[model samples]
Target: MKDYDDTTWFLGQWGRFQQTVFFLLCASVFPNGFGAFSLVYLTDIPSHSCLVPDVNLTQDWHKAIIPIKVVNGKQEWSSCSRYRLDVVRNLSALAYVPGRDVNLTDLELEACVDGWTYSRDVYQSTVVSEFDLVCSDQWKQPFTSTVYFLGVLVGSFFSGQLSDEFGRKPIFFGTMAVQTVFTFVAIFSPSWTVFCILLFISGLGQISNYISAFVLGTEILTGNVRVLFSSLGVCLAFAFGYMMLPLFAYFLRDWRSLLLALSLPGLLYLPLWWFIPESPRWLLSQGRVREAEAILREAARKNKLQAPQIIFDNYHVDADETEKQPKEHLSIFHLLKTRNIRNTTVILCMVWFTLSTGYFGLSLNTSRLHANPYISCFISAAVEVPAYISSWLALRYLPRRISVICILLLGGVSLYFIQLVPQSLSELSVALEMLGKYGLTTGTALMFVYTAELYPTVLRNTATGTCTTVSRVGSCIAPFLLQLSTYLKYLPYITLGTLAVASAFATLFLPESFGRPLPQTIQQMYRRESSLKCPFITRKKPSKAVVLSESKL
Candidate 1:
């Protein structure tokens, strides 16, 4: 029987139909860029001091009311503590000035019980300032990001099965709607709890929309076009959206306004439903050959070509034979049922987890960089454009394993070396951090293409979803990893760097899939063989059955 690629060759790669699907799908992912990392500005903790009410006091006493603590070799007003207001008032009445007649250090300190006066020099307002998520409550800020990733975790868990069960178009648009509606509604949340709950729900749709677009593109587009779409098309769209985030945040400093700006772009994607078609490969897998053929005919028409009347003659037979088996048996457990697949899944999971951790850790930590938060974030998002371009080139030419290893090591080394840069050369530190981000972004873009190529058509969505779901675990931990910096300034970098390098080594175990046809069955999955010269360089040949099946094409 002819495979999906050969069977649908009439559609022509890079034709009008492919171009329409490619651009529209990429456009669909634009909102996700900002939606994923908006929390950076939304939850930012600006410079704040305890809010002291007006009392009969000298200017020195008013300034001295807030305790001073040395941080990083410089004395600054304490954000969380202040001298006792009653003591300051009494001292002022005695005609005694702070540090003149009385030592300011002698005054007792108290928590910011009254409230905090947040500086508006950077952000007009953030979730941290609005909800007073400062001092002891500061933990909630990072936890808020974690909560959204937790939603991504849950959404990724089911997105695969849902996409596979239904068609790709439905799930893609459906999740986009879910994300948009929830994010829009979240702006009106009365409390942090309500906001978090809405964020979690929106997260479910965010990743699902992204994954669905990926799978749909990979399934519909063929050969180099598929590789390009996977590597640059979808990823750069996301990068563009991500880049737009800082621009929006730069203008809209208020958390609610920024969120509302992010939420509104999703509405622009609603028109895409009519333009993007469902994945025909998925249609054929479900024994819906007629529907699949109809889509192909329309594609052929759009491309100004004639498709044969009997497009899926052999495919129909193959689909019917496969349909005899019970559908319920094809669960995620099937991935682990075979040794070759099990090994691939395990290694890929580890790689995904580590990459996700490093990617999001650096992304979310942009606000903390020793630069303007807006510029830092903009630079962070901007770097991804070239990173993905590099990824596209690598995916198109290099072997998958070597690409993964080199990029991972680049990220790891750059991040690990950050601590060695002298404090005086703070610019070098930021440069190393951006370099690390560049490497990870390239690695992340390549992984999507690599993973899609490794799995069979039947299990592709499930496998991709599983890997992303595992990666979300790393994302969920990412915000807290930044929190580690409070104790040891370079802790997050050291940990993320170590994990990236370790995962690079893990990639050595997986078989290469570049220049090989995507497998259609578990039996066709790449298995380790003693005949290969170099594990990383050599691409494994398909089994005899798959070879014979493709020869017929």
Candidate 2:
């Protein structure tokens, strides 16, 4: 059969057919963007303190029940602990002040017997507020995000294989339905435990839909357009969607309403199933020649181009031979089988891990930044637009290795210096943190196209899926990393910065892929040495005259 790229004979590359598919696939990514990070707002811990029960007492006596505790060297009302109820009741009846009538230091402390009262200045309702997920129960907040990411990890591991075995279209539609339905269902979750379980199932479909769309685009498009679509097109859509999330959260105020707003858009995507065609290349690879031909012709007709009467006529291969071909089950193991492949796989996974940690770490920490959470989130998502644009340009013009390294290095440096910004200038600290986020976001966009170019088509999905699965470990750790801020304010930034720097160095071992044809098979990766080296660095062959003179011929 004719190569998929040779479709120029019957259809135009940048014509109606490709653009139609590209935009629709990108539209699907809009929801995936916000869905990935919604936990930041949904589970946010609002200002909370121990609830005081009904009692006839002076205002001072009521104030004495909840004692102030030192946090970060500053005194704030304790959320978890309170003064003994009996002592407080007796003191209130006597109109006693702690320091005046009783020794304040001698008052016994006890855990919050009454449920907490949450401040509703920002959030009207949240899982943290609704379920009292503060103080002792605070651990559950991060665990919720971790559980969601665990689902992503499991989905990423298997989705690619399932897509490869079945058609991309089926997995795409299936996951989209799962993502939409479950996310909406989660709003009515009976308990925090049920909400988390629904979140996990939603998470499962989220990454799978994204990966399915990504692979479909890579397989269907050709040359620079493919790079453009992968780096900027879908990524930009995601960024825009993420930017809108703050507006939703800001207006909704209630977590359940915000979730409903996030999920309701998925209904608009159902019609996409009819518009998107299956990957014709996959059909050909499966020896379904007639089915593949129909798709190509339909594409040509849609593009308003002339048709070749016989599309795969010149291609000659026996159907029996195709059936007899070895059905090798490609797995992540295939990535580690060879020397060069093993080295490449290890480095790529590390790069993915570091990039993801920085991205999610910053994304999740917007609430902690000394600014309006809505504004912080908007700024965070807004920077990704320019980052993605630069990444798209770099993918086209610059060597992939240098592009990734420079972006990551900048991110690492920006993160490292955040601690040096004086607390008096909280704005400067937020700006520096955003600068680091910009760098990491750029690197993230670049890595998607870079990894796709590195792996051959046969193993491309498996490799990308494996790398993304490893990256989820970073995402899963991000919540806990933010939790470390309670111990040392700058710990998460320092940790992410350190990882970004280390991964930049690790990226040096990877070969550059710029203006070179994508590897088609595992064998091609092993046989081709020059294809794998830095494009800007090369050894010069000796000139013929110099060789003759040196030989004294």
Candidate 3:
């Protein structure tokens, strides 16, 4: 609510620099967090097919009907299991394994496959028509990637609190340094278990870096710009995240090398810290009005403008211990207890869970030594851009509920078609993913921006963080659900699609939140909804000439 229009420094070049650095800094998340998430598409899983052979299984020994176990994407157990069965067939076709070990292979090795396969999603996939790698059953995939997401969930939940308490710049730099250090440890871990453990821990650090970028970005802009571009920042980062995905997969060549390549972005961002300024908004919020004033003066000095006469303490920040002793007590825990808040959380979480599972589910499965993993990744990422553009349009022009409903519906129906599509037009398989991507991406972005807008600023950070946490709970399950259905890929998509639609419909009960100032309480939100639909109520303005005549009700 504080206006910096009087602050002469924010009016020119410094403002532009601040906005530019904010975006570039957030771009680091792509190479750090998302690169790990997309590792499934890039990692090579040992695969074999009962139906086809792309490599010479006989070079090692004569094989026919080789059950090749191909590790497509990150090496998880579900992928391993499918790869193991397929590998054995191809191994047997070239030269069979001892007959007795087949049972042992299935039993003793199931754990290994599970280790490689258990993603956060529930459904799973294996080599069927497209993917055809035939080689060593051993594939290197880091389980630490899941741990990284767990870390992200935690870091994102608390970044606002920590950055506000500490300083935005410190948390940002510290977390990036941590990411660099742990990434090196993971790259050189002697054992896979040790590596995964470190990877999980690294995620906690990497996630906070993303949060710092968001907070800093918001603080740098005016209200009108903040509403549009802050949301645009996420879209840009994600779009670039998806675009970088295929590029990384194409270059890194191996999981370790790929990870090492991903870590280099930290170094790219580290140099930026020197030029980046502390958030003036956060400085005021933390009661460091003097420092806020100094920073504003610095920005003005950099822009060659004089500081305005405005005092540093002029802006009122509603947060912190003194002014907020009791008023800050919207009670973060209370959000869970209220029926409306609870409903909003559940609906949002369901959408996030389904979108990730459906989108990542299909795309990840189709990567790694397919007819073309690069082509597949490119197509899927390409489809999602439209989703982002569509969302930006929806936010710009349409009502919240209707716009959300349309995308969710498109995504849901498209999912069902995946079950019936002809593989000959095989590209359509990935094309359908757009439906889910468009819906889920739009919903998630909208939910984050809208959730903050719905709650009072006192608990705005808490509400958005809590909502993201619920979505993370869903993310924790996406890997498992995604891999569970290797034998039946369509089932998971269908179920996820349905859940997305249902969540969209559920959202209808919540009122629209466009152009209105955020409500100070859940009670305020409800009262406003009621006022809009007040029955038998009409107001007529008396003509200008009759303004002097007062009416008594």
Candidate 4:
């Protein structure tokens, strides 16, 4: 019954930094995903910032120092004029100056001659209107926006096996480093199509790295602390990440600049090579005893405790002592053949799919709700802040099933409410719709934690990948489904709500896994999955590391 010090326990285990990794990882994607996505609309803000250096005047000194006198003939170096210089230094200050006295650059002076001045006009007057995605082909827009999630689907399948065979730490860093490169490339794409293609590449890295990060988290730490660091930590990283987009956009304007600003931080993780340790569980799985022993010894040293006389490297867990379970191999296909894990997978997948669609659908639909679209969108997202705390509390008391069911049901009902409400109330209607949006967001957090817990260790990441992939399928469909709502009225929300309900109900069959040992195989998941009411994880007093030939290991 030995445990490491609470402070140094998770602190030593590489997984403790999962939140750090997730926050960093999420930071890497947001500039492109949230930044680029939000920037398409906000990009014009910088063009506003790119105004003439000195054109801000409201008062009039005299009638004749007009823009024509400033940089009229200086079209070649128009931005270098005295007016431009003054404007750059004191834009707001010039507002008090006489209008006639204020000078403008060549283009500005030309627009000013007839008092037909249009401020902030470099991109195009029609630029904002281009959003009339009504007629314009969005072939690349939809793909670029979601290609990362799709890449997750693909990466999850292979990353799990890679993590299994190659080890978590390497794949984790490898994928992230590669992802960082693509993320940079994604930022520079000339068009949305290229951006999306690059993001697709980065997405592969994002999902696989995520699995490895979690592998690190689960390998180290024990007790409630382990649970907290692994689950709530990731949940918070996403919540905080969503919250920061507007802030990042506010400070950094150029979409490309913003993307680079966000991505360059990932380079910070490269130095993490020396700090984080390889997963002890993964090490044990590979029968790398000497390595696992070294890691365990370090864990003991960090916590100032002695390593157990003999570290049990075998898959056998003694229920009498540690309540550990016997290991079983669970293949991806075998997940479907098994009843409980299969059931959990289906329900989790549905829940994941519905939430991804609903969350993105609402994000896409904000403009449909108001006059000041960005303002409305900002407030709508603000409401999700409380859900993360509520979800954390809910996880503490309620089981994942109840939490998920309630959240998804809430989402379903909320979506229904969105269409049911009259559009006349305007802002209030958007807020109501956002209630469901927040629910879907919360449901998504629940799914990430709940799904990762269902399978045995070997298949966990693979299972997580499967869940991630299925959800991306839902995300891929959301743009079309959400846009279709304009023609069909309540169809998209209603369809997503129905799916949420089905996903919620699927939880009924899954054994609530809270406060149980993480299952490591399909057989363990089925016949005797319950830790609350189980027979024995081990029959003997956990013998020495069981030697396994290549056939066994």
Candidate 5:
């Protein structure tokens, strides 16, 4: 029997049909680029000080109202504390010069009683400024990002099962609508609590649609076209969207307006429904052979070629034999049923967790860079372009395991070196950080492609979603990881770098999927010889049933 790829070979790769699906699917993910990281600007904390109420005071007294404290070595005005207003007023009446006549340190300090005043140099308004989520409430800011990732975590758990059960196209578009609508509604959120609720809902849609689109595209396209779409095409579209976020935020400068701008673009994607089609492979897996054939025929029509009268003549449907077996609902647990897949799942989970920790940790840290947040964010997003291009090259030419291991090591090493640079060469520090981001970005892109290929169609989305679900745990903690830098400079880098290097070493245990046909069933999953050669484990020969199944494929 011919495999799906062999059966579809007549359609040709890189034709008009493949290009259309590639671009449209890539376009579908464009909004996800900006939507994922809009929190950087939405909750941005700008230069600020305690708001002083109107009172009779000298110029020096007004300046004296804000207490100065040493940060990193340089004296800077305290953002949360201020001189007691009553003391400042009395000092002003005494004609006391803050530095000349009286020592400012003698004055008592108090928390901002009235409110806070933020400089509009960077952001005109943000959640941080509007809600005063600073000082005592400062923890809310990072918690907000954590809430969003929690939503992503929950969404990842169900997206694969839902897609596998219902179909990819509906879940893809349905979740896109969920993300768009909730984001639009969030712009009008009256309080942080309300905004967080909406953000959580939006997150549920965000990652679901992202994974759905990824699986949908991978299943629809074949061979190297699949490689390009997975590695460069979809990722670059997302990076472009991310790149555009800072530009929009730079002009808007208000959290609500930036969110509005981000949410509205998703509406443009609704038209894509007609242009992109469902995965024919997924359709066949569900026993909808005719529907799958219909989609392939439409693709052939778009490619301006005539599909054969009977498309699935020599193709075998795995579902056909199990039609009367009560239709078992496959889940993530199925990935653990066998040793080969169980090992793959365990290693993939580790790789994904570490990758997410490094990638999102660096991405969210962009706002804290010693430069304009907008430019820093743009640079961060822009760096992914080349990284993804490099990923495409690596995915095309190198073995999957080597590519992942090498890029992960690059990220780990670059991040580890950032602590060696002096403060005077801050530019070099930023450069090394970007290089770390570059390496991680490339690894991330490759992992997306690599993970999808590791599992058979029956468990592809579930396995991918499971891996990404685990990754969200890393993302969830990434905000708190950034906070560690304040207590011990470079602590986050050291931690993330160590994990990256460890994940690199772990990659050696998984089988390489390079230049091999995607496995269509659990029986056909690629197994590495080294796994069997482990010193502590007993090697077993393949069962007759497994060998017979492989022979049939």
Candidate 6:
């Protein structure tokens, strides 16, 4: 019997019906993009120093309380320490001058026992300011982002099975609501602990909605539209949302207000519940024949076409003859059932982990860039446009393995060289960092497409979800990785760069999947072989005769 793709040709592939679903689903992804990285602005460390007590003192005496220390070769007031209050009080009692009689350096220093003053120049309010998550609590700042990603990891793990068991539409709408409601609630969190808890829950919902929408689009659309929607539609919309985030943060400097602004947009997506249909493929897999038929009929009617009167007629006919055949329900463990499949799964996991690490690490590091954080973040988001376009075009033309390796290597090399850039030329360093991000974004786009092509349909979702879970492990640690700079300044970059390059080599071991049809069974996946000559640097095209022979097989 013909597959669903063949059977559904009459429903109109790229018609108005499919286009509506594609764009609306893509719209759902926009908020996720912003939400995923909002922590960057939310947790940003504004200029701060220990709050000096309000006392009538000379200008010189005022300066003495917050002593200047040379940091990174630049003299700046100490943020975590201040002159001992006893010494300052004694000097004031004596009515002595600050520099003439008193040696400020010789005086003991102490932590900000009273409170800290914050600079409102860049941000009106941030989590750092609201909770005083600086100095002793500075570690908590990056921990918040880590907690969010841990939630994403949990979401990715269960989203597939839950959607597969329930239905894509319900899971999609439910997760979207959870993400929106929790995010808004987080704004009112009374403590950092509460905010982190809400943030983690929001993450679970965020990834669930994202992956569900993605799967729904792929199942509903056909041919090039599926590729476009997955690679360009949702991906581009995500980039657009990311770009909009810095703009929103730039205008709304208060973190609570910015979060409110981000969460409020979910109201626009509520209408999609009425419009986006359940995935007919998923419905059929669940043996919900009537539901699948109804959706197909609606799709045909909207596209101004006619579906087969008996939608399941062919499926029933095929099932009747194959009644004696045992149906296989593959799980994640099935991925390691064979040597080749197990190897592919391991390599893909490494690739995914490295890709996610580099992507989030560079993205979160925008504040470290020399330029204004808003512009730096905007540039980071903007660079994805060309990077994604390059990825989309490369997937259409170039060999998949070659594209993955080249971009990974490029990103890895650039990240390593970023250490060589002199701090004096901050612009040059920022440029190299953005360039590395470009490569990382391209690799991210390519890996999703390549993984889909690599696995058999029987275990594709299982494999993909598993890889995504592994990637989130990297994402969870990414913020902590940034915190490592406290121990050694370039540790984060060196770590991510090394992983990217190592994963590039790992990509070389995986089979080339360009221009290949997806396998439908574990047997087919095992029997598959690399068609590309070198599977490394070479990109020779197969002859027409060879292509025809392979198709005949």
lDDT of 2 by residue, 338-371 (tens): 5567889899999999988889989998886745
The sequence of per-residue lDDT tens digits that candidate 3 reaches over residues 1-553 is 2444444334563364545655665565565444445556433443322233344554422231222343544332233223344555455575554454344344222223212312212113211101222223232232233455677677667764566556678987888787777776676765556765777667667657765665566556545555565566666676677677767757655556666776776777777777778876555544566887777776666656677766554555334213432233344565555444555556655655555555545545555214666666676666656766666666666777677667677778877788888857666766666556656666666665666566544345556556665565555555555554676857777777787778667666556777665553344444444343213345344353322111100
C-alpha displacement of 301 in model 3, angstroms?
3.5
Q: What is the lDDT of residue 282 in candidate 2?
A: 65
lDDT for each residue of candidate 1 in 1-553, tens digit (9 for 90 to 100): 1377888887779999999999999898899998998998999889999999977888888877888889989999899999999988988898898888998777788898899999999999998898899899988988999999999999998988788777788988999999999999999988999989999999999999999999999989999999989999999999998988888999999998998989988899899878898888777767677888899999999999999979987663344334342142266776676545677899999999998999999999887565698888888999999999999999989999999999999999999999999989988998999999999989989889888888766678888899999999999999999878889999999999999999999888877888888766544563322223454466556577644433222
What is candidate 2's local distance difference test score?
A: 0.82
Two-way TM-score contest, 1 vs 2, winner: 1
TM-score of each: 0.94, 0.92, 0.72, 0.71, 0.94, 0.91
Deviating ranges (above 4 Å) for candidate 2: 1-3, 7-9, 314-328, 529-531, 534-553
Candidate 4 segments exceeding 4 Å error: 1-134, 191-193, 313-331, 368-381, 529-553
Candidate 6 positional error at 438, Å:
0.7
lDDT of 5 at 409: 97
Model 6 Cα lDDT, one tens digit per residue, 1-553: 1267767789767888998999999999999888999999999888899988887666777777998989878999889999888778778878888878887778899999988999999999999899999999988988989999999998888776676567778989998998999999999999999999999999988878887887788778877787788778888999999999999998999999999999998878898888999988766655566888898999889988878888767763234222312233456776776555777999999999999998999999887774589987988899999998898888888988889999999999988998898878878878888889999999988887788768754455667777888999999998888878879887888988999899988888788877665554444455464342443466456456544433322
TM-score for candidate 5, please give it: 0.94
Q: Which pairs clash inside model 6?
A: none
Ranking of all predicted structures according to TM-score, beginning with the best and ending with the worst? 5, 1, 2, 6, 3, 4
Model 4 collision count: 11
Colliding pairs, model 5: none
Q: Candidate 5: which stretches are off by over 4 Å? A: 317-326, 526-553
The predicted structure with the larger TM-score, 1 or 4, is: 1
Kindly list the per-residue Cα lDDT of model 5 for residues 338-371, writing each as its tens digit.
5566778999999999999888999999976757
